[model samples]
Target: MSVHETPRRPLRVSFEFFPPKTEAMEETLWSSVEKLAPLRPDFVSVTYGAGGSTRERTHRTVARLVSETDLPVAAHLTTVDATRAEVDDVLEEYWQAGVRHIVALRGDPPGGLGEAYAPHPGGYANAAELTAGAKARHDFEVTVGCYPEKHPESPHFEADIEMLKRKVDAGASRAITQFFYDNDVYERYLERVRAAGIDIPIVPGIMPVTNYKSLMRMAGLCGASIPRRVARLFENLDGDPATRQLVAATVAADQCLDLAERGVGEFHFYTLNRAEMAYALCHMLGVRPT
Candidate 1:
């Protein structure tokens, strides 16, 4: 008898976290990190707040991760409300702090989404320029964001693909997509990206839906659409945290398994500084601790 192997590549997962604002939240973040670290993620990224609002907090969290853990940490850099020199200094700081990977972004304006983005007088205009600048500064492995449903500011998906190609040309080693629920949407976007001749690992961003209202809000801002069927799954679980957690895990697991069966090997999860759900999802996906 012939033996058929799994026919799937080993799944590689990474996570994204935001720097905490208070002592309690900081503890929670570290606890989550400790809990998820055992699954052996490829890396964990720390996010910068809008317009560099969480600049110092992000730096401190990243630096602490460098000092305290054996896990690889990626510092997020943004060209929002900061000059070229300012951003350069932050990059240098990350280097000195033992962070060699960066997730470069053209951050949202301080006034928030829908507000016009104005590049600082002496700063990089967008993620592509920021990627180039980081490459020039150091041999950092830079990753940039792409949107599967098209960026809110982008005129269309074609333009978004063109901009993504520019980022790759500028020096991005990989592109991690914005959080998306629809695997078909991601597959279609991948086809376009490949057709456009952009060759780089495009990791799907996964956001587990623990809070329905918050997820809807974020989906609106990032241009990710939630399917009506999935919406109906969370219809009556609003007040039950226990039931919501189960639904969230089941939905995320189904999504990941579908992508895996489609030959997707890498996943970048937006953990939202919570570990239980993400850890549960990883466990469900067979990413158990070594």
Candidate 2:
């Protein structure tokens, strides 16, 4: 290390996990949780499935986090097919169970990805409306979603920025972006967001790519483009899990390091309910338990 080299900033990170559906998956989820718990991330989030299908399981997992660990847990809530009353009840349930933060979203419809989303007959119409609803019920610290590469459904970038501003106005405290391989995309998005006067913490969502095929599928669905250079790095590692994991950790750590150099200090990892890759990325970024 040279004296002229720049100092790395302290990084604050959070992990996202999903509710387990089966007994073995449940055990796996808890084991992953135990492994990452020691790092004491800023907060941990649990995802809600499309159309809120995993509502009960998400609630159960969050409640257990509250009771079993001294971690700050954020529960994902989505307005998909449920009415406002139903959504309100779920928020109250989380409140009673000691969850304070929420990632409110207008989730994918039950029809699945690429299908047009129509709000429930008596439900909040979009994420901005959902944010308002959550704030009305309780003074929750709400987080909303953002897309660096314009959302697939959005007509243009300007419209996406407008929607984010509306969500902020409706009481959302932060916005987490969809995962993207290009840090420049995020930097440009931040400029646009600030130019539009939406002042909120826009956390970059980092997804460590352990499986190339699965990553491409999600990137397709979310409109994140995989730069050909990155694609070249993972080419032909399909049958070699060890090499694949190494490439994944290195790619993700490089992404985080590049962003950190640009003055971004916070990151939210889409853990896919695994610990090794995310844990390794954090270590590479110099983040450790407090």
Candidate 3:
């Protein structure tokens, strides 16, 4: 629709940010968080790096947000290289720090995405285990990841849904999907999920594509598809960063509005620790700063 014609239904949004490695990056992340805070997202989440590499940074960032912002913050906790005790200790720390929500994950290998994934010698086996452990440790509201296109390791979609079912049974309250380009893909996945009787909220993960080449590489690693039209939108703007970002914002905003038409109320944005695009998206969706 037009800029003035927002979706009539109310929308719920959340943004994801990664822990920063440098002082400058941390400043940028905090600025973005500050800018978006007034819009009042459903919750804001900080990502844990692969294999718990950013455990301390993630904790520090979440604690700061809890202390400084009124926003409800969700800390990401992963089952990767750490032992069960180590992971449980982090859970206690989060609870003590006033974090009530967790994004439990089975992270990639310590070696990175291309490397083979293995549980630690004594760690939780997967996200389901982590979810159960998180709930048992502190009664945190747990959210787990779901792959609408099926996880790269899963042999089929059924297997993926079964894994999600296990997470739900383990007390996860919701699932956030991997970023998807096609709304039809999300709808089909939702249909299948309902058919299988897994009814938890599956919030769509929205990623604004500002850099075409970077997105292609990331999408390849994560098994997210790139539609040709999306590629075409960024085709000749590689040298024009400003124009490309505008296109990115428009493309993602259109996707979100379209999703609103399809009965989706909740959206989780992968902010890449930047606010402009995500802010633009919310504005377009009629979420004004309050």
Candidate 3 backbone collisions, by pair: none
**Candidate 1 least-lDDT 10 residues:** 1-10
lDDT of 3 by residue, 1-290 (tens): 22121323558889999999999999999999989998899999999988788989999999999999899999998898899999999999999999999999998888877677888999999999999999898889999999989898888888999999999999998999999988888888888888888878889999888678988987887778888877888888989998987888788988998988777878899998999888888888778787
Residues 81-114 of candidate 2 have per-residue lDDT tens digits of 8999999999999999999999998898797777
Cα RMSDs of all predictions?
Answer: 3.5, 3.6, 3.6
Candidate 1: lDDT of 216? 92
Clash totals, every prediction: 0, 0, 0
- Candidate 1: RMSD over Cα atoms? 3.5
In candidate 2, how many Å is residue 133 off?
0.3
Candidate 3, which ten residues in sequence have the lowest lDDT sum?
1-10
lDDT of 1 by residue, 89-118 (tens): 999999999999999999988888768888
Give the distance in Å from residue 189's predicted Cα in candidate 2 to where it truly belongs.
0.7
Please report, in order, the local distance difference test score of every candidate based on alpha carbons.
Answer: 0.89, 0.88, 0.88
